[model samples]
Target: MHPSRRAVLAGTGLLPLALPLLGQAVTPVRAEPAALLRRAIPSSGETLPAIGIGTSRRYEVAPTPEAIAPLREAVLRFVALGGSVIDTAPSYGTAEDVLGLILAEPGLREKLFLCSKVGTPGREAGLAEIERSFKRMNTAMIDLVAVHNLIDTAMNLATLRDLKAGKRIRYVGVTVWRDSQFADLEAVMRRETLDFVQVNYALDDRVAAQRILPLAAERGIAVMVNVPFGRDRLLKAVQGRDLPPWTAEFDCASWPQFFLKYVLAHPAVTCPIPGMAKVAYVEDNLGAARGRMPDAALRARMETYVDAL
Candidate 1:
């Protein structure tokens, strides 16, 4: 793992959450279909589900057969619960392979709106990586392809534009998770005609809202949110703090829902991708996509609650 990725996971104290639990059949939670928000790609008007699955650490480390079984079930549960967008990358070791295996199951391929990233810094290398991703994903065409972290982003975006025009990829976008790259990301968002932009934004991490999100809304670019729980740091912050009762107003049944709904409520955010390996966690995360989202006034109260904590 990259040191930065390790640091991101370590900062969130995810090891405990990742501990293996006895596999139990997860009962699907009955959540009414929340109001679905739709956004159009600037170049193409294709609409996408507003909540996506981030399969970074979540799918990268299942070394044992026992460990992989639950993930297969989790993927099924995710689709059953109305999840369609799944984000993965070549850099996420073994995640693309594992997702490929699960997706090969009968009726699984057509159920997903797949998104993957090219981590290589050069145009040729990035295109080669995306080709490998196509083979690993067991799909002829992918739904979305992004330049991961904007490494050689301009070159990669140019390549993506060509591929998108040829119908090899449905949407083209870019992602930046680190705070240091915000300025560059803003420049790209302003100058590039993109289908989407993946960003790090959560209730506690509102910096993106100050600029990136607004630009995306103005540019008619769909937004895919990564690290919605602040890479799990926000979960740690709320560990001891009981969820406020007013959270129930939006049918937020857990802290995950509370945090996720806050991000999903943003009109600019088309989706919030949270990574999880467990079937129960998958069901829980999908619940955030259902039910009433906090309106502006209620969103303020949520921020205040988190701030007070």
Candidate 2:
């Protein structure tokens, strides 16, 4: 029961608003339907916005003033929309350097709940990379440090544990995106003492719901979802399709909202980090954070609807 384009246009009354006056900056209208929703991290009971930004390939840009301005705006606007967590890594080309320049703004740095990872193999290499992240991101103490893709899991987790003990980072965790890695990922979640785990989940990919997500809930590990859009595959699937009217029950206004609300409905999900490179995308994604989330039955309906597409 998707709304027709004309019906949506008529309901929103977008045709009546006048253009901005000259010399007056148009403030982006955000959906303040309610306060931005938050979920607690299981280990420390710290809470974060239900939706966060993932700067993977998106934030990797030439570290020039002009080149980095849009990214800077995205970061600033993300905070303005009540976002806190931002996930990045050294593996993304020039991403740390560009983000470093943006976060050099003292206000912006303080506003973010920053998380980065150690990707190299040995403890020495991991330590060197960790120090480099500290330098590149211009932060003395990071909010979280994870073993990217479970690389050198034991060695890197040991280093993260030491750093956490030393108070260089507030939390320690791990991340992986492939379903093939879920067994190994689940093993670590079971055997190790971790504070968080980032895995792939979206309306299009529900593999995490089977075991990884449930195990995280059982083990008291915070879950950060990556690939919430299925790397744009889901968007392409619904390209010309309108969102179902029942999505409004969860306060969803767009396909992205429909997708994100589905992921967040799982009690184990702390945040879903969808990579956004533009201010408009940030606004849309942040809007998803403010609205009501789907209930179990609604989530099942959403899954069935998407499966049919």
Candidate 3:
């Protein structure tokens, strides 16, 4: 069974009353037209869909077999809808295992740009985590393995580089989710050779755009965006607001699309992974990937509209 909504909210530091009850079943609703946008990996030029899924609080808290059933279907729906990237980590409870079970099915493995992270503080621990991730993900080779939160960057990157050299992984990267780490993250971007970097950035949180984003572009490092909805905080911000008619000029059909489109508009963003347990939310999130993204003038209008709210 799924954890009580109260329990899940507590784990995520959100109040229980903010979300619907857990036992109340939610149905998966597919988007009318599956939308997809592609962005290239800086090093290999491999194109990944601009929208991806993240397994953090959503999958981490729902570790039981029955609780994960819908998640499997969601993953299948994600691929069916044209999404290619799946971002998870050893830290995210049984997320890797859940993904492994789904991907083990025929044709699903190749459909994913499988991505996971290593966050242990030492080289040995990091390597052990990598092995565990591979085992749990049921993949002999992962599309990307990132150093989570920049922990032991020097050591983990060295090991990941070795793994990449040995043909065990396709790309190696590093990530930072907190603002405090931007300095260290920028330093790593300047000094280290990496294929990608994942960071917390959203329309409401533009701090990363100041330096981290430009640095990534300048250094030819692909960027994966986390918390594009600001962990549901941004969702609450736009709750009852209708999509302004002008939002359609850039192809935004819903609030999630508006928020995601804002982030993907930046030339440097490779993908944005939004976490969702329900397939409906996944479909809604994927809609942002379709058609045209905001150009400079439209982006300015988007900023003004969001700021006025």
Best by TM-score: 2
Model 3 lDDT per residue over 256-285, tens place: 888899999999999999986787777777
Candidate 3 deviant stretches above 4 angstroms:
1-35, 61-63
Please name the candidate that would achieve the greatest lDDT relative to the true structure.
2
Instruction: List the candidates ranked by TM-score, beginning with the highest.
Output: 2, 3, 1
Measured with C-alpha atoms, the lDDT of residue 237 in candidate 2 is 93
Compared with the true structure, all predictions reach lDDT values of: 0.81, 0.87, 0.85
Q: Who is ahead in lDDT, 1 or 2? A: 2
Task: Give the per-residue lDDT digits (tens) of candidate 2, residues 1-309.
Answer: 554322443455433234679867565552233457899998988889888989899988899999999999988988987898999999988888888999998788888899999999998999999999999988888999999999999999999999999999999999999899999999999999999999999988899999999999999999999999998899899998878778778878788778887888888899999998998788777767765789999999998998998
Q: Which ten residues in a row have the lowest lDDT in candidate 2?
A: 1-10
Q: What's the CA RMSD of model 2 in angstroms?
A: 5.1
Instruction: State the lDDT of candidate 1 residue by residue for 1-309, as single tens digits.
Output: 112212322354422334345874444433234444544455566766666789988898664567678888888877876778899999999998888888878998888889999878787898899999999878888989999998888899988888898998889899989777899999998888888899999988899999888999899988999999988888999786667777778877778878889998888888888997777787667767776889999999988887876
* Clash totals, every prediction: 1, 0, 0
lDDT value for model 2:
0.87
On TM-score, who's better, 1 or 2? 2
- What is the TM-score of each predicted model, taking all chains together? 0.85, 0.90, 0.87
